[model samples]
Target chain A: MSWAWFHKLGSPKWFFSWSKPWALPLFCFGCLSLLIGLVWGLVFAPADYQQGNSFRIIYIHVPVAMLAQSCYLALGAAGFVFLVWQMKMAPVFIKAMAPIGAVMSLVALVSGAIWGKPTWGTWWVWDARLTSVLVLFFLYMGIIALQNSLEDQVLANKAAAVISVVGLINLPVIKYSVVLLETLHQGPTFTLTKKPEMPAEMWLPLLFAVIGLYCFVAGVVLWRMQSEILMSEHRSSWVKQEVTKHGF
Target chain B: MAFNSLTEFLMMGTHGVYVWSAYGFSTLTLVWLVWNTLATRRKTRDTLRKRFLRNQAR
Candidate 1:
């Protein structure tokens, strides 16, 4: 693939300005879609014949679990970019994404526990899927703590990048944990490789929720990225001009 | 709607506590994360702009 456009993305000023127009709209769309999906999934969608209304939690749980894993993948990819191309924005992306990923992982874990109590009759069990996800949460916390512990920004980014990449090995394990082991956790309701084992009525809102969550994550990242760019590049001429232009 | 009334929806059949707690926690996470990031961004920008202006005066 051509590398020219890829390098252009390295420029924070260009990205900050280029992403501005769509970011707000995307966030609003995410909010709107999530609201609709939640209402549809919780109120209108038929209750599970087995799990009953407890299955309503799936609308939130699945989206967040997917986001937690997806964000880690993103962190790993950004780490790779930082290590290889030394893209300035890549490290900034890693820093910005870590907390967001951590929170999502936490929500996934907590929601899983909540969902588990009613279904499994316990708050937590050392099931394969649950354990792997707990590990994911810890990995996210490790990246955040590691980034903060270092004094030198560049060195910190580099060290964290290595950790992120190494942790990328866990992604497949988390995804396949249920299939590979005897897990109390249910199998994937939505899989890209094959038709989901859920009805259209159930999976349809789930689709919306996933897309909405992704959009939400993207918008929040861009929001933080713009702020990160401004703060980091405050002394740069472009940032100075923008500050004056915006009367900030 | 799956339930017959507002009360039924709140009850969520027999699993009301689990359902509500999960949703409540998820909502809190989403709200708090977004709020904290925006707050941090605003504070950083304000502080940076202040420093920039002070530098300009010197």
Candidate 2:
């Protein structure tokens, strides 16, 4: 209930100390859940009569795809924070998260391509959903490039933030593309208003995989953010003390 | 169990290649993401440590 904790999050030192204890546990839990989900989906869940075992790819595909969109939303929110409030940690979040977002998009695209081969008889499609996601990937790449290319840190952060905030226009496009357009991609598998169309046995492992991937991303973002903090704050005495204490 | 044996599970009733490749590639990438993050952290700290030592010597 206290906004004090929220304000403290803007400080790199506080965030570093707060997140240090959490990173490893989250990463471990993520890996464990992912292991369980993948194995259960592959070995225990019933195979789809339509797509057969290739449907197994859905376990990974859906989670990464979902993450791809949500991560972009995070980036946009961080950008907004950086531009409006000028929070020091906001740009760090952007820098740390951009590569992860890019990689997640890559994984989703690749996994979906692999899944498409068996189910759709094609490896690639120019459908609205697919094309928009491809643009999303490019948008992530552009943000990363913008951040790295500028020698001036302030300018780089500003430019990246601008792009990130503007790029938010695409999320809704990606979300609605399947429904709004005549596409080969299926409609939403999971929605809050109604239960998923699939049986519990099938969607349950998917649920695990989704939650696991989210935890995994959170842990990684924390790790990367800590690293970014140390690098950016290296000249500060507390950072020096941390570096000495950790002996890294 | 969805399949009768490990072999059947691996084969995935003839959809093995597609299923396995997707999992394999994505898993490798995820592993790389973790590896890269840690490596960057270590590398950053190492640079900072060396800078400290250098400053002390100076």
Candidate 3:
């Protein structure tokens, strides 16, 4: 495809119009898939012989934890786009994503703690995996705070971008911290090089949830981006015409 | 397959509290996220509408 097509993505109005058609259906599909996955994994899927029903928590914990890291990567990418191309939508995307990501991380941490209570016989641990994830959560909060605190949007994006890039140094730290610290936390259940040991019956639903959650996040982000575009482009003719056409 | 019956599943072999709490918290977070996203969109639209009217009046 032409690079010009890529450049057009920089236009907020164009993206807003483009995303409008796909948002609702994607959101609906996401919600449906999430519900199905949760029910299937929690109620129908066979539980672990060793961990018993406690392993069901994996349905939520794993997905949220994966999202927690991936969202940060997305933020970092958005920051890079903002800095390099000065995409008007980039800061808005970062703004919208930060709180969502922070909350996801919080959920991951809390769920992991809950899972830990019975499995590990403790709610809190100094284990490397747990500690590093905690740090990641804080990093997400820091980026959000930095963005909110700045008066200038451009400056705020820059500050948050720098923080996000620096924070990326921790994703690997979080992943391998268990190995480094040699703690109670188990090694990876799933890996790029190795197929997950989980049975197809269990993993299928988890995979569905992962895909659904990604779509859900995308739909939310696009919706937020549209609003941001409207806010920032209020003076532009397309936005004015859009508002008029929509009877807003 | 983990439990012999529905009762056992709910009981979770004495770890019910921890298991249920984790699921409960997960559900709450999912609900809250959906609510937050919808509310934000509505609020943004309302604010934009108000601004548009204000500009027109000016």
Per-candidate alpha-carbon RMSD to the true structure: 1.3, 1.0, 1.9
Instruction: Give all TM-scores, in the order shown.
Output: 0.97, 0.98, 0.93
**Model 1 per-residue lDDT at A144:** 94
C-alpha lDDT (0 to 100) for residue A169 of candidate 2? 99
Model 2: runs farther than 4 Å from truth?
none
Per-residue lDDT over B1-58 for candidate 2, one digit per residue giving the tens place of the 0 to 100 score: 8888889988998899999999999989999999999999999889998898899899
Reference-based lDDT, residue A7, model 2: 92
Point out the higher-scoring one by TM-score: 1 or 3. Answer: 1
Query: All models: lDDT?
Result: 0.89, 0.93, 0.82
Candidate structures ordered by DockQ, highest first: 2, 1, 3
Q: What is the per-residue lDDT of model 1 for residues A115-222, given as tens digits with 9 covering 90 to 100?
A: 999888898999888888999999999999988999998899999899899999999999999888988999999877899888888989988998999999888888
For all candidates, what are the clash counts?
A: 0, 0, 0
lDDT of 3 by residue, A64-127 (tens): 8888989998988888887778877778888888887887889899999998887888988987
Per-model i-RMS in Å?
Answer: 1.4, 1.0, 2.3
CAPRI classification of candidate 1: medium
> Runs in model 1 with CA error above 4 Å?
none
What tens digits encode model 2's per-residue C-alpha lDDT throughout A40-159? Answer: 898899999898899999999999999999999999999999999999999999999999999999999999999998899999999899999999999999999999999999999999
Better structure of 2 and 3 per lDDT: 2
Candidate 3 lDDT for residue A1: 57
